[model samples]
Target: MTDQLPDAIVAGPKGPALDLLHIVQINEEIKSVVAVAFKINIMALNAIFLAKRAGTAALGFGVLSNELRSFSSQLRETMLSLNALIHASVDGVSAMLQDSRYNDILERAVVLASKNKHLQEVIEQRENATDQFRSKLSGLRRALRSSVDDAYRLVELGGVLAKSAKIEAAYGAGFSSSLSQVSGEFDGIVEEIRTSLDTLRKSSFFRG
Candidate 1:
C-alpha cells in the first residue's frame, strides 16, 4: 500500500487523519525479514552440500541443515501472511479516513439544513459504513499481531537450530571448518531477522 493518503483525507478539517507512515515503516521491516529468510534458505542449502562432502561424519549437520531449510520456508510463509494483513489494514484505514471526511461534510450540511429529512438518512448510512470499516480494521490488526508473534517464534527456532548446527559442525571431520563457517552464517542471518521483527513489533500499528 502507498504511504500517501489523499490530501483531503490527511488534512481533514477535523484534524490530521491516521498517519500511514507507520505502515510504510512496517512494510520495510517485513521486507528486510523476508530477505533474511531467503538468505537462510541459501545458507541451509550450502550447508547441506558441505555436509554431504564430509561423508558420514557430518550426518547430524546434514539433518540440521534440512531442518533449517524447512524453518526458512515456514518463515517465508509467515511473512507472506503478514504482508497481506498489512495491505488489508491500509485499505481499511483509507476507507475509514474517507468515510470520516464524508461524515464531516454531512454534519455541516445537516447543520445548514436541519429540517432536511434525507440528510439524516445519509448520515446514518455513513455512520454504519464507518462502523463496518472499524470492525474490519480491528480484525486485521489482530491477525497481524498473531502473524508477527508466529514469525518471532520461528526466528527463535531458527536460532536454536543454528546453534545445533554449530555443534554438529564440530563433527564434520575434514570439513569441520567449512561446516562451522556456514553455521556461523546461519547465526548471523537469524539474528538479523530477529532484530527486524523486533522493530516491526514496536511499530504503532502493532500496539493496542
Candidate 2:
C-alpha cells in the first residue's frame, strides 16, 4: 500500500500539464530573445557597409562601433539570462532529489514553480518593450547583412560567444529571490510528497 500511487499524483496528473506549459513558455522566451539579439548583431556588421556606401566607411568604425557592440551585448544578455533560469531550475530540482530529503525536495519544487510564474511575468515585460520595435530588429539585421556582405552564420557565431553568461545569471536571480517566499512554509505538503517518493523508491517504511 505504501508503494502505490497517491490519489493526487495518479488521479490529478497535472504534472504533464505544468511541464508542457513551462516548456512552451521557455521556448517562446528563448526564441524572442534570440531573434532580438541576432538582429542587433547583423545591424552591427552592416554599419560597415553603410559606411562604405556613404563614403564614410573610413569613419564608420568611429561612429557606429560603440552603438553596435553595446546593442549586441544587450540583446545577447537577455537571451543568456532566460537560458540560465531554465538550467538553474532543472539543476536545483535535481540536486534536491539527490540529497535524499523528500520533504526538502517537495518544498523546493513548490517554490520553483512559483518562481517560474514570476519569470513568465518578466518575459511579458520584455515582450512589451519590443512591441514598438517589432520588426525593427529583424529589419536592421537584413540591412546590415546586405550592406556588409557578411553571412548570417558569422553573426550567429559571434552571438553564441557573447551571450554565454545570461542564462545562469537570470535564472539564479529569479529563483533565489523568490525561494525564501516558500521556504519552510509547506511542511505538510512536503512531508506527504516526500513520503510518497520514498515509499515508491524503496520498500522501507522509514527513510533516514
Candidate 3:
C-alpha cells in the first residue's frame, strides 16, 4: 500500500505514538518563528538608533523604539526556549521508541491479543508520550501564531511612527527622512511575514 503521509507529519493521528520525524519538522517551524522575531528585533534596534541620532527632537520616538526592541527581544527569547524544549522532547521520544522496539513490532504481522504484557506496557507508554507531545506542539503552534500577529502589529505601529517622523522632519524638526525609509522597508518585510504566516497556519501541521 502506498503511504499517503507526507515527508513530515503535521498533526499525527490522535494516538499515543508519534513520528519523531514530524516533531523535528515542527521544531524547524518553531525555529523559523524565532528567526522572524530576531529580524524584527534587529529592525527595531535600527529604528531606535536612528531616533537617538535625531537628538532631543526625536526623544519620544527613541523611547518608543526602545520599547519595541525590548518586546521583540522578549519574544525571541520565549520562542528559543520553546524550541529547546521541543528538541529535548524529540530526543526523549526517539530514545523511548528505540528501546521499546515498537516500530519493529508494529511492522510485523503480530496479533495484538497474543502480545506479551511487557510489549503492551511499552506500547501504552509510547502512546501516552505521543499524546503529550501532540498537546504541547499544538500549544506551541498557537503561541507562534499569536506572536506572528503581534509582529504584524509592531510593523503597523512602525509605519505610523515613520509617517509621524516624516511629517516632523518636513516641519524643519531635527529629524531625518530615514524614518520614512525605514517605515517603507518594514512595510515590505511585514507583508512577507504575513504571507508566510498565513501559509504556515493553513498547513496540516496547524490543523486541529
Candidate 4:
C-alpha cells in the first residue's frame, strides 16, 4: 500500500501551483481581449461620427453605433475585473507555495540530521513543525479552491459578455468587422479559460 500522508502533503501545495500556472496564461489572454475591446470601442466611435455626418439618413446607424460602444466598454470592464482576480489569486498561491517549499526543505534537513547520534529530540521537534506546516498547506489548498471558483465565475461572465458583443456587432456598420474581430478574440480567450477551469476542477487537489 502507498503512504497517504506523503501524497496529501505533496498534493496540497503542488496542485495549486499547477492551477495557478494555468490561470496566469488565462490572465495574459484576457489582457489581449481587453486591447481588442478598446480597438472595437474606437471603431464604434468612428462609426458614430460617420453616422452623425450622414444626418437623418443614418440616424438608426447612430443608435446602433452607440449601443456597440456601450457593449465594448462593458466587455473591457469585465476583462479588467477578470485580470485583477487572476493577479490576486496568483499572488496568494505564489506566497503560500514559497513558504510551503521552505518548510519542506527544512523538514528534509532535519530528517537527514536524525541519522546522526543523539538527534531523537530534534526529530520530534521537526515532526511537530511538519504537522503545523501540513495544517497550513491544508488551509492553502482551501484558499486555492476558492480562488478557482472565483475564476470559473469570472470566465462565465466573460463568455456571456462575448456573446453579447457578437450580437452587438451584427447591428454595426463601419465597425462591424472590428467588433466581430474583438468578439472572436474574446471567444478564444473564454475557451482557454474554460479549459483551464476544467483541468483544475478535475484534478485531485481538492478531493476528499
State which candidate has the highest TM-score: 1
Q: Name the lDDT value of residue 76 in candidate 2.
A: 58
lDDT of 2 at 116: 78
Please give each candidate's TM-score. Answer: 0.84, 0.32, 0.56, 0.51
Ranking by TM-score: 1, 3, 4, 2
Q: What is the Cα-based lDDT of residue 30 in candidate 1?
A: 91
**Cα TM-score of candidate 1:** 0.84
lDDT by residue (162-187, candidate 3, tens digit) is 44544544432555467666655555
Candidate 3 lDDT trough over 10 residues, lowest sum = 13-22
lDDT of 1 by residue, 30-133 (tens): 98888889888988998888888898999999999999999999999999989998898778777777887788888999999999999999888878878788
Better of 1 and 4 by TM-score: 1
The numbered model that scores best in lDDT is 1
Candidate 4 backbone collisions, by pair: none
Which candidate order results from sorting by lDDT in descending order?
A: 1, 4, 3, 2
Candidate that beats the other on TM-score, 3 or 4, i.e. the better one? 3
| Runs in model 1 lying further than 4 Å from the true structure | 1-19, 110-117
Off by over 4 Å in 3: 1-22, 92-176, 190-203, 206-208
Which tens-of-lDDT digit does each residue in 76-149 have in candidate 4? 66666656665665666566566556657766776777566445665567568656655665565566566556
Of models 2 and 3, which has the larger TM-score?
3
Identify the runs in model 2 with alpha carbons over 4 angstroms from their true place.
1-20, 56-66, 93-208
* Model 2 vs. true fold: TM: 0.32
* lDDT (Cα, 0-100) at 115 in candidate 2: 65
